[model samples]
Target: MEFDLSWILLGLPLAFVLGWLASRFDLRQLRAENRQAPKAYFKGLNFLLNEQQDKAIDAFIEAVQNDPDTSELHFALGNLFRRRGEYNRAVRVHEHLLSRGDLGPADRDRAQHALALDFLKAGLLDRAEEALKPLEGTAFESEARLALLAIYERSRDWPQAAAITRKMQASGQGDFSARQAHYLCEQATAASAQGDEATAHTRLTEAMAAAPQAPRPRIELARQQHRQGQPGAAVDTLATLAAQAPGALPLATPLLIEAAAAAGRSAEALALLGRHYEQMPSLDLLEGLVALDRASGDATRPGRNRYVEHLAKEPSLVAATQWLATEQLEHEQFHPQIQRALDQAARPLMRYRCAACGFEARQHFWQCPGCQTWDSYPARRVEEL
Candidate 1:
């Protein structure tokens, strides 16, 4: 075959031109698709900023359909569904992401976390726990463990909570000793309620060993001792607590007074309480002092007069009520009414208040019932606070 040089030269440039034209057309098409994706994404963002969650979800859905490979958009849409309380839809989206083989490790972990959140929001605690378990070796380990701990606490699984706390402590998540002690105390309380005094005693001992500086263990242990007819041991325990955690002495004052009376250690308890009253002058400690004085056969006037002294230091209505309760009024007939009003006024002030959630209760709580916060209630009464 004869070669045609002119034709060959012309064909080479024509083919080159054709190839360039096709490449340009493909690039333009890709650019148009990319532009549509961002337009939908921005529309979703605008709707979200406007708090139109339904519209935002629609826009995001459109964006996701346009760019099916976009992991970020999928995550955003899933989270929006979760925020809107559409747990089922959120779970589906995150599960879809997880099913994708093309997803990176980080995205996979994020999808898992999002799925767990959906389950948690839906109150599917079992599923949530299962989802969170896999995140232990991942970057979300701390957060997942914390969530797990909360779940265990809410479920009253003391042993599980303690185990999680131990792991957190071992990981240097921060000192969880106090929390661990609380868990042990919770276990002890359950055991005591079930009449397992031996188990309760062991758990309480463990709690005290876990956090020696914590006042709850010592206080609880003393109460247990008193209940077991070991008033001397109870008094000794409270004395140790008063010496170590003096600020918590007010919380232990009533128990200490009872223990002292039972153990014939009134003089020693009186001296200890008097020393604390001099330093801090708490209403509870003052009450303890008055009780001890009365028990020791001190003069009636001087023993009850501590309330008047407390009133001199603090303008406390509770103190005034206490003082008036023991006083001989000039208008004796009207004294009952006045005392009743004062007593009513001081009743609310005697409540314990949660520092974290402002919840008030007649008795002290180591954990807040309102917000499920631990160690939120201070050892002082509301009026004292």
Candidate 2:
């Protein structure tokens, strides 16, 4: 029980010295680990900047292995895999990140988004949809919903696309009324093809109601009415369209002529078309005017004469061809060859072209096949545009 003062004093300093040395060792170890992680990351970044994706991937893998807890590095690696078209590896990396309990809520959401992107890029739409569903109510909700909408559209799932669009509209994404109307029109088209005229009519009516100013719904509804042997109703629908969406009358010209003739309202339809042509002077409108004139037996200026009038206004090859078709050349024997050459030259000008993607087609499309853009194609023909 005797106290030793010297030994007590010596032990105190030794304990202090040991504690200081331990702290120094820990700091040095931490600095070394940090340096190693950054070295690998910078190597990866250098490789990426140099366009050496293979080496970049290798370096990123090394960095991830060295700093397993780094969520940012994991994300980078996952993205690189996806960019390289290694979707499986990208999916696995993101899934691994999700499985880790230490991940934060934000990181978990990010990883889930990355996994969905991987599935989408791999063309596994079903899996992508499932993965994207959980992102609702999160910060990534808008992005996920947009992806889902695209998937539904690509699959031609009109109802699902409409539902997603409605949600987007509700969330203040933008006004999707026109797009919703298009979906209903697509549904009507399918129903009509299946011989469900009643359903098609209902859907077309709903489409018209959804977007009163949209031209497609009225045009489609009129077409459906005409097909169902209701020419008078079709004429009425087209007349409303002419008053409200007159800019789109050219696209609906042929339909109008047919409906007018069937309903015994050729004169009224001709007057409406004449007014539109006076304002816009579209070739389609002029063609519609000529058809109606011929149908009504106009003697002063025949259908073919309208072409010469159009040629006077616009120096169009299409108009020239139409005018020449009705003319009797001095060398009547060579008329056929001349007409054929002119027709061949004017054929391409009749095609509709997309303003967004520069895609040309014989028929106008509400959505572009090349770029999947809605209302990308103008109603005007290539020459007119």
In candidate 1, how many Å is residue 349 off? 1.7
Off by over 4 Å in 2: 1-27, 330-334
Compute the lDDT of residue 23 as modeled in candidate 1.
Answer: 100
Candidate 1 structure quality by residue, lDDT tens digits, 1-385: 9888999999999999999999999999999999999999999999999999999999999999999999999999999999999999999999999999999999899899989989998999889999999999999999899999988998899999999999999999999999999999988999999999999999989988999999999999999999999999999999999888999999999999999899999899998998989999888898888887777777655777888888888889888888889899999999999999999999999999999889999988888999999989888888898
* Residues forming the 10-long window of minimal summed lDDT in candidate 2: 289-298
Model 2, residue 71: what's the lDDT?
91
Clashes found in each candidate (C-alpha, N, C closer than 3 A):
0, 0
Alpha carbon lDDT of residue 41, candidate 2? 100
